[model samples]
Target: MDRVTVSLDELPIRDDLRGQKPYGAPQAPLPVALNVNENTHPVPPEVADDIADAVARALREINRYPDREFLALREGFAQYLGHGLDASQIWAGNGSNEVLQHVLQAFAGPGRSAFGFGPTYSMYPLLTSGVGAEWIGGTRGHAYELSPEDAAEQVERARPDVIFLCAPNNPTGTPLPLDVIEAVYDASHGIVVVDEAYQEFAPRDSPSALTLLGGRPRLAVSRTMSKAFAFAGARVGYLAADPALIDALRLVRLPYHLSALTQAAAGAALQHATTMLRMVDEIVVQRDRMSATLEALGYRPSESWTNFVLFGGVADPAATWRALYDRGVLIRDIGIPGHLRVTAGTEEETTAFLEALAEIGAR
Candidate 1:
């Protein structure tokens, strides 16, 4: 009995999955949770009432399969995006992750490769592998910035079937310049996905990759309700691209993948877009405050256009993470050497996180 070893390694798993660990982010109930970059603000009562009413109406038809086309939801999204996109050009999924998977499944497969700038969203390589495609991690320049020349050069060499560019990127909080997006789009013969999951949090003047969608048949821009809409639990994400590209996604997506309740809830939220997104201004304020605090303590905080700040120069990020956790404030240590990411919470939560970390940083 003592010699018996129990483990998943003994099972017959896919060769590619061997020794691979499941994705992990701390979900423990802490005094303050700024780890996942979630919009910490709860849905306003007025907006919540509207969503509840919509979902309740949807519940009456719960026995039936949801709309496979999700046209109404698409129309809602098109109206919200307001970039002259029609319903035919918009596609949605359970989340931006699922939307990404749909894009890869439809465009990438065995014998094809995908490329992304290094130290960006950690999910890019994982999603590439999930679609049975080869993954190429391309290098970014200083401060995790993707330059046009580097983007073009890498795309030319890899000649990948798919390319992912994350704007206001996940852990680094570095937003890509539009010229870089165009350079990659021009260089790539295959599909280009500009993930704008954090678009709502960027500065007003920060250009979105959506602006470059015209005349670029191969490009798509992905966005989500999770970040700024305070709709993470609704699990709605969408993309805008050429109608032909959206049609291709239809081939791979499972029928009725988005439930009726989800569509109804998201549509309701979009109807109250102004109210749902009101917290964004407040979050941006706190984000800048966090940046200022980190810099004042002599840490190198990345220039953030998102609701989170990535700071560097931690003598020991792991220890600091542990120290913060001990104090009931949780943040993310994204495995980037000497850096940590913290989401902007409410004023009180932000104050607690900042005060707790200040002592640790000083020590």
Candidate 2:
């Protein structure tokens, strides 16, 4: 019963994964946690009741495996997305990370390369390397913007086996224009993935990459319920693509990957999509408020189409982060030099962060 401690290097781990770090944010028992870009609002009681009822019904069949195809959940996602999609054109996993991993497994791996714009989703590289694929980081334009020309040029040069385009890109929250997706798709001859985990937070009138899915057999749009639906605890994410691509994913997924309970809970949440999305508007208000307040306080807040904001211009990021941490308000110091990212939380939480930040600036 003696304690045993061994470092990862002592084991037979892969060479590529030798020095790689796992993806994560700081976890702490802070009063206000805006670090991980989660929806801070509680689910509506009525929606929660519906989900609980669905889960209860699913428990009656607990002994049975979930539907391998997850047809009903796919149908719910198709209906929720509503760009003339259907169940056959949909696939899902525990979360969008797993969905993206499935893509890497089927399309990338073993001497192939995956490409993404630099400073994008950190998971793209990790997922690629984990699958034995080389990760090629492409460049973005000024202020983290990716112009159609620049994006297409980069894709054409790398010609990676799989391309991940994080729409309204993560960490920085810079919006990605549909034309850029079009340009990248046209330039690359490989599988194209548009990670739209934050699309719901974008301007309502803006077009989605889903609009470009038709006739594009190699393209996929991935989404998650964790953000706007306040379903992070349930861990549901899905994709919309050609039925052939869906079939490709089926090859790599474990049997009965989506549990009956997960399907039931997500399906019930989709049924109350309207109620769930009402929280998005409030979060958007907080996001905008945070951006404006940051600007007024002399920080350079980036234009965000997601539920979070990445602001720069801090003179001492480490000291400021420590000060905020000490104030019991937690946000992300995502290693962008003077920049830090924060999720849009409830009104009171946002106020607390702003007040803390302002106080730090004053001192």
Candidate 3:
């Protein structure tokens, strides 16, 4: 049989999707891959063994569908988050992206719009457009900071059907204050989502948006096991909101959306939350180290509440990125004119990236 091929344009695709690029970072088999803000540490062996045992136990009943409500997993998240939350107030999906998509599906669609500060998570606009909603790119203040006053003003003026606040914003690693989240939620008449994928990496004393959930039904805080738990490959993300808001997402989610194996593995991992999060303290150390060294090397590294650092002062981002690549290290050139982002990997990996960057400067 002859192979049949056709370009995307030749098919009956959505007009808005045409010419739109997908969101992703370069994936290379380098010695040190620190582009994505992944927890580069390996999961503790004992915890991994426990997860394996749980999955094996779940495999015995693979013939039956998983729990539609995922009640136990919700309970685990509730306990982990512990802002007086309950399973009734929880919802989850394969990843944080899907959780956000469910919110968009339930709240925003054709003729409605979703708004977010510019240069935030690259997926916000993509997810919005995927649901046939308009994406409003609101602006951020200097150094990608969004103040309470400015944030509230933008939300009020845009009046979008949904809004996303990437806490400790992606790519830039700038922190998002709880006051700003409060202002945005209060100013908007629609649903507001706070993505806290990196919340575990933030200062232990720093408060989470989860604290703001009281009496605010339209506000939700989404989290992922991918970052702090070193479970990125497992694809577990969850959210906490008013029970009413949680039910709203049910309308858009597929039945038995989470698989039995996934639920089992994630539930088991949650039992070892303390062991799982020990890596976070080490990662934070490397993140601060990277900032100090980058600044010493003439790059202005931004204050990060996440597992990565976005540094400026690179004369040419592409060349610096390429130079690092050639040295068996990988980082990100997130399209900022003179900025590059690198995850705070293991101490050795972080050292490799910094050394390669210094060598490039020398040359």
Question: Per-prediction RMSD in angstroms?
Answer: 2.0, 0.8, 0.7
TM-score head-to-head 1 vs 2, winner: 2
Two-way lDDT contest, 1 vs 2, winner: 2
Measured with C-alpha atoms, the lDDT of residue 111 in candidate 2 is 88
Candidate 1 regions off by >4 Å?
1-6
lDDT of 3 by residue, 1-363 (tens): 999999999999999999999988999999999998889999989999999999999999999999999999999999999988999999989999999999999999999999999889999999999999999999987789988999999889999999999998997888998999989988999999999999999999999999899989999999999999999999999999999999999999998999999999999999999988888999999999999999999999988999999998989999889988999998988898889999999999999998998898998
**TM-score for model 1?**
0.97
Listed per model in order, the count of residue pairs whose N, CA or C atoms clash below 3 Å is: 0, 0, 0
Q: How many backbone clashes does candidate 3 have?
A: 0
Q: Give the TM-score comparing model 2 with the true structure, all chains together.
A: 0.99
**Local distance difference test, per candidate?**
0.91, 0.94, 0.94
Q: Give lDDT: candidate 1, residue 308.
A: 92
- Colliding pairs, model 3: none
TM-scores for every candidate against the unseen true structure: 0.97, 0.99, 0.99
